[model samples]
Target: MPFYIRARTYFKYAEEQMSLAEKEKDPEKILKFTLEAAERAVRALWAIVQVEAPKEKPPLEKILAEIDKACEPDLAEEIKNHVRRIKELAQNPSVEAAKEALILSRQVVRRTREVLEPIIGPAKRVDQHRRFYF
Candidate 1:
């Protein structure tokens, strides 16, 4: 599939996972879903730029550094910082961390969707009646 399509897929999944993360009571499960949302959001960002994202959970800072080193123009500082915060919060999952993760994931995913919409078309009218309300 094309990078745009992949980006949309990840963006959708990340949003779905975020919903689960929000209602979760267990810290581990919260972290699991939070990390998934964060990683998938990062993947969407990479795909929007037509590049491959890391499959492993190496430090997000390392991955961002690699992107900065390789991509012609790095992702906006806003995205980089959000992703870094996500990684930091994921380390020690707790009620507070989960709250922060949800906030961070929401911002990053919303921004990714905005940046991708013009290139790949708006996500408002997607199939299956599934909406991504960032």
Candidate 2:
């Protein structure tokens, strides 16, 4: 799958899982779903990083640095901080941690979109000007 598509899919899954977690009464199930959500969100961010910085599977830090150069410093820092928080929370896996991760992941996605909009630009629609006559 394309990076954007995969990232979007993962993010959607994360959102769904988060909703499920919220509705569930059991603590264990809530944790499980929350962790799943966090994992999906992290995966989505990874996809975004891969798309933004194509460097033969570079380390996350390197990718973040590349992103920093490509985008605004504050946005880059926010993304970095979110990635760090998500990683940390992924290790522990708690409801609060998951919520934090989800929020950060959403921010990362939004910021990534903002950064990529100019780089990717609007989609071009080609028009066929010539008519073939037989």
Candidate 3:
């Protein structure tokens, strides 16, 4: 398929995952959707870079560096902490804690999108115009 179509599809999947995470009564599903959202976003970004920058693509470290650069230091640290917690949750998600995880995942998704906007460009952002009220 075409690059733009693929990007849109990935974004849609990410949003679906986000929605599922919010409605998740099962702890495992909550953790799964959190990861699914992050993974889809990262994969979409990488695909965009691969298509747009091809032969001169930026390294993964550089892409992550750019994301980190855009975020506030404290916010970046908090994102990291959440990532670590998500990994732990993947091993075991309790229904009570999973609700909290869903909230944290949404925050991460919002911040991550902000950090990635420059890399993904205006087209993707245009699709995300509707905000998810927390």
Top-TM-score candidate index? 1
lDDT of 3 by residue, 55-122 (tens): 56454345444444435777656766765676667777688667666777777677656655654455
Task: State every prediction's TM-score relative to the real structure.
Answer: 0.68, 0.51, 0.58
**lDDT (0 to 1) per candidate:** 0.70, 0.60, 0.63
Q: Write the per-residue lDDT of candidate 1 for residues 1-134, one digit (tens) a residue.
A: 67677777878888888889888898778877877887777766666665555466455555565544323344456667877777777788788887887787777667666766665466655743675577
| Candidate 3, superposed: residue stretches over 4 Å from native | 1-7, 52-80, 115-134
**Candidate 2 versus the native: TM-score?**
0.51
lDDT top scorer:
1
Q: What is the lDDT of residue 55 in candidate 1?
A: 64
State each candidate's clash count.
0, 0, 0
The digit string of per-residue lDDT tens for model 2 on 1-134 reads 56777666766686677778667765556556655665555555566655553546445565555655545678667767776776666677666775665566556655554444444333222123343567
> Residue 41 CA error for candidate 2 (Å)?
9.9
Say which prediction, candidate 2 or candidate 3, comes out ahead on lDDT.
3
